[model samples]
Target: MAVAQKLQRCAVSQTGKHSASVIFLHGSGDTGQGLRAWVRDVLKQDLAFAHIRVIYPTAPPRPYTPMRGALSHVWFDRYKISADCSEHLESIDSMCTQLGTVMQEEVRAGVPKNRMIVGGFSMGGAMALHLACRYHPEVAGVFALSSFLNKDSVVYQAVQDRKGQPLPELFQCHGMADELVFHQWGEETGVQLRHAGMDASFRSIPGLNHQLSRMELEELRSWILKKLPLESSAQGQ
Candidate 1:
């Protein structure tokens, strides 16, 4: 069975007219409410966010393999921290199925699949990449902050199956000084993704560690605005 949790919504659209949506997942051990509080502050700083509906979905506490089966709020379970390590496919697929439902709900709620973006931090970012690159290619874009993929990820195989078809745009940002998820892993993921015909861009943040920065968030905001601009009808209102 898929693990589930109540998602938290932050309606940034001040005019009550949303034209786009961003579903952002939080890192391992963090809850949706925690990330929503932080991102809400940064997003509100930009007027463009006023038309975007942000969804933060919490991962239910599960037995994390890396932590010796200790419970953690992670999108999936992995045997280790290395990007080259073996993947826990069962857990990963279950989470993807759950996220797919979330996307479908957004579509049913009036947001087109092409106007939605999936992104996250750390483990959450990895899940975002898995969903956008493998499961939900129809999303507008995907951004991974301080995250990476397994060296032999199923995402690569899924892309190969497309036979040169295009997937959603991808923006990956990593801290050069990150010790947990190395910058090299993020760069390699981007390179492999491009090799597989994905529209992927990677940004290297010098002197950054395993966390996010204001500059990184600003860059992400710019990318989001470019990917999902306000519709003509909404702009004229």
Candidate 2:
């Protein structure tokens, strides 16, 4: 299949000099504009994010199996979760290739691989996890919200073949009450990452659903701040 053009993106940047870039992908049926608003609201009150440039890329409209073949903005076609919780590997490689183009643009624009963070929600988060592990392994961190990994997928096999490379720091969160992506799957994703030698941390939000909660957002904020500090500080500088 031919590689798709870069997806339309919505962006936000701090006023001062930026030291890092964060690319966040939205879930199915959502646009980058929607994620931009959500991320802006989540980080607006915090000054620690003042030196980061945030990018939200819209996924292409395609047939989604979870929606019963309805066309929606999705990184890849998601089939039914198997009994072993492994996702179908079809289209994952192509999708990651497209996402890698976006990362390449960021690198060409002067941001180092180690100064970039990649993350997303739901299916978007699944893409982020795959990209970080297989394609952009040198990134600063990876965040997967209400998402899981397919250990049997091609990406996992590729990562397993690479030797002596450091894995990125990972912070994953899932709601105990999440009906869409079960909490157990998220826990398994964390275990897989750790077993692959990643510095992975998984957070479970009690009584929360698939949707974002204030407490979950706060926890994510803390994790991001801890992982990527303000550039104004000496340590960060």
Candidate 3:
């Protein structure tokens, strides 16, 4: 018997025939609907994304250790903020499985693995990075906004093992003034990825906070266009 599809709570948008897909995971304490609305507004002014399918998946609400065991939708359990940010391997692995399922569904629906982009904000972005590093079926790109990576040697080893697979182009945007994730952590994450032989681009936005800014979104749009160029016929249509 085929396994039942346990689809994560998500909000989806597909304008025309879906030639490409972008999965955007929401941050902790945020809903898929909220991220979907934000993405919709961002795409409204840019018609180039009309043919791209965007999905915002909500993380399952669970007890967060960093928040004193308060329940929230987080990608993984909070880890110590040391030089090597330790994470719960089990939690990270579970979320990666969940995200992989979502990606597989898109592939079954006719989208190619290379044409799909995976990204997220804050905690969600961190998970995206983790997922991309450890999983198979390379994606087109990965966007990590105001996020960091699991500095554990195990995580690095997983990435090293995937050296044979084509690494996805990574676009990391972080606010220099971010208090939650810390700007330093973002910078170090980029460096670490590069040292591991991944093509990672880290953009530092000065004076911004832990949240996404308009400038960051604009940069994201540009990055998307570079990865998945809009068809000429679709231009100005």
Candidate 4:
């Protein structure tokens, strides 16, 4: 028997068949219910996806072995990202397992792989993208907001492991004024994604800071609507 992953998540939905599900994986220090506020504030306006579900997965407050046993519920073990991200391969492997498990559960929640999207901020963004590389059962989209791939990694291994297939639609949104993670880093990773022949849209939000803004959330909602199930769109509208 496989040990079920220990994670906390908050799910929001109104009523409808729901075309797609947007899973927001929060950063290390945040809780799953955190994004719930964002959804209620922004997504609730549409009324289209009254049944659209947004699932937020929370990282625990435990010690992160990725940082040499440091105390933090991180997606993967940290290894001084700027220098080299490949060194943390082992930790990334563990993180991938938990992520895959979470994804599996979501699929069973009525949203199949193709009708799903994965996204997050900072550490959460990196992990969301990592899952995108290995996306199976298919995925509608991926978003990495104000974050970068492990320092200088093309993520070739994970890409190759996807049976020589390609990644799903992906968007890499950066904040020009983000001081936490250099805007250039996100740009570079976007380049890498494009180089890999994936449909990646890299947008740097001018005058924005580290956190995702209301306008950004609206953009996400719009993107989802354009691609979400037509039935869902009709119901939402």
By the TM-score metric, which is better: model 2 or model 4?
A: 2
Runs in model 3 deviating more than 4 A are 1-7, 38-48, 81-83, 231-237
Model 1 agreement with the true structure over 144-227: per-residue lDDT tens digits: 999889899988888777766757999999999999557889889889888888888999999999887778898998999899
Give all TM-scores, in the order shown.
0.91, 0.87, 0.87, 0.83
lDDT of each: 0.84, 0.77, 0.77, 0.70
Residue 232, candidate 3: how far off, in angstroms?
A: 7.8
**Which run of 10 residues does model 4 get worst, by summed lDDT?**
42-51
Winning candidate number (TM-score): 1
Q: State the lDDT of candidate 2 residue by residue for 165-203, as single tens digits.
A: 767788888999988547887888788767756778899
- Give the best candidate by lDDT: 1
Residue 96 local lDDT, model 2: 86
| Off by more than 4 A, model 4 | 1-4, 38-48, 64-70, 81-83, 135-137, 154-157, 160-166, 232-237
Give the TM-score (vs. native) of candidate 1. 0.91
Q: For model 1, what is the alpha-carbon lDDT of residue 203? A: 94
Residue 234's lDDT within candidate 2 is: 28
